[model samples]
Target chain A: SQTIHQWPATLVQPVGSPLSLECTVEGTSNPNLYWYRQAAGRGLQLLFYSVGIGQISSEVPQNLSASRPQDRQFILSSKKLLLSDSGFYLCAWNPSGRKTQYFGPGTRLLVL
Target chain B: AQSVSQHNHHVILSEAASLELGCNYSYGGTVNLFWYVQYPGQHLQLLLKYFSGDPLVKGIKGFEAEFIKSKFSFNLRKPSVQWSDTAEYFCAVSYGSTLGRLYFGRGTQLTVWP
Candidate 1:
């Protein structure tokens, strides 16, 4: 069974703060990892995706970046957060050859 | 570029009512379709997927979706709805060699009243 884990389940940060959200997968190796931001009525927006370690493809230009430091570990970071950066962050993964993706619990960030 | 379109943004239905959520994709090439459900306060879960073979795919919780290649539509259907079925449903399309790059439609929020 494969599972994805994301943390700080919920966070509240002031504007102009640094942000880092981590995602890790279990029971899978060399999986395709993705970062998405979900907003109410806006659906899930693709942020970044990685095929392997040190390889990240960003979908949209934003105040954030992603890194695949380890095979199953992905991190989303930002040097300075903006008020518009607050949303539900989701991490997902699928096997290398599959198109079906599984999502994590998600991190709700509130930038005040 | 591939894109998905969900016709309904919000739907209100009573218990025992029928459900038909429309989902359409713009890519005519080889594509994989999926429907995901997100219950209140829960993560997204796969409701069903269409890779090939049967055009009609059955999923858990008595939900099913039909893939119409000519129409480019994969609409979800349920015979009878329950109050517990209140959740947001998302339609996604994936094609080419983009790996996990799935184009998602703005989800349809289904609210069932008992």
Candidate 2:
């Protein structure tokens, strides 16, 4: 069985601070990874998706960026955080050419 | 560009009542549909999906959804919803051969009173 891990589960950061959220998937290789932000009342907004290592697609340009360093490791980062950047950030992964995606526990970031 | 629309933003129902959440998509091609449930303080889980074949797809926890191709809709239904069934339901659609990129709806929050 495959498992996805994300940390830290909750984060509190001041404005203009750097942000880094990690997501790793075990038991799967060459999986498609995605980063999404869920705001209050609003649905999920896809931020980035990676098909392979060093290949990232930005669904919506914003303050955040995503990277796939290793086959199973994905990272979401930001040089400076904004108040609007605060939300429930979720990471999801699925096998290549598959429609179903498995989501991680998610990171709740609060930018004060 | 593909887009999904879920009619109800929020719904309040008593236990044992029938539940129906409307979902529609705007895409003129072969597509895949999925329904995901997010329990309180938990991650998103797949309730059911429609790839092909059966128009009516049954999911876990006694939940089901019907896919109407002509209507471009996939509506989730539950004959008797339990209090544990209270959660947020999301409808997503993937078009053509893009299997990993899904367009999600605004989502419908279901609240069931015990």
Candidate 3:
């Protein structure tokens, strides 16, 4: 069975602060990873997706960026966060060529 | 670009009430459709998916959805919804060739009252 883990389940940060959210998947290799943000009462917005290591696609350009350091590790980072960046960030992974995506617990970030 | 639409933003029903959540998509090419349920404080879970074969797909928790190709609609249905079914439901669509890029709808929040 595969499991996805995300750190700092909840965080509170001041404006212009750096942001780093980690996501790791165990029991799968070469999986497709995705980063999404869900604002309150709004649909999810895809931020980034990676097909392989060092390959990242931005769905919507904003204050966030994504990186795939290892096959199973994906990180979402921002040099300086904005108030609009506050939302529930989610990390998802699925096997290559598979349509079913498995999501992690998610990180709730509040930029004050 | 593919786009999805979920008709109901919020719905309230009593336990044992039948559920029918409308989902529509706009894409000329072949596409895959999925329904995901997010329980309160939990990760999103796959409720059902439609790739091919049966137009009607049965998912976990007594939920099912029917795909109408001509109508470009995939509507979720449940015979009798329980109070535990209170959750947010999302409809997603993606091109068949690009499995990783999914376009999600605004989502329908279902509130099944006890």
Q: Residue B108 of model 2: what lDDT?
A: 97
Model 1 off-target regions past 4 Å?
Answer: none
Weakest 10 consecutive residues of candidate 3 chain A by summed lDDT: A37-46
lDDT of 1 by residue, B30-52 (tens): 88899999999999999999989
- Kindly list the per-residue Cα lDDT of model 3 for residues A1-112, writing each as its tens digit: 8999998899999999999999999998999999989998788888999999999999897888899999999999999999999999989999998888888999999999
lDDT, model 2, position A48: 92
The lDDT, on a scale of 0 to 1, for candidate 1 is: 0.94
Candidate 3 lDDT score at position A86: 94
Query: What TM-score does chain A reach in every model?
Result: 0.98, 0.99, 0.98
> Cα lDDT for residue A82, model 2?
97
- lDDT per residue for candidate 2 within B13-41, as digits (tens), equals 99999999999999767888999999999
Off by over 4 Å in 3: none
What are the per-residue Cα lDDT tens digits for candidate 2 across A1-112?
Answer: 9999999999999999999999999998999999999998888888999999999999898898898989999999999999999999999999998889899999999999
TM-score of the candidate numbered 3?
0.98
Q: How do all the candidates rank in terms of lDDT, highest first?
A: 1, 2, 3
Provide chain B TM-scores across all predictions: 0.97, 0.97, 0.97
Better of 2 and 3 by DockQ: 2
The candidate with the higher DockQ, 1 or 2, is 1
- Candidate 1 per-residue C-alpha lDDT over A39-90 given as tens digits, one digit per residue, 9 for 90 to 100: 7668789999999999999999999999999999999999999999999999
State the number of backbone clashes in model 1. Answer: 0
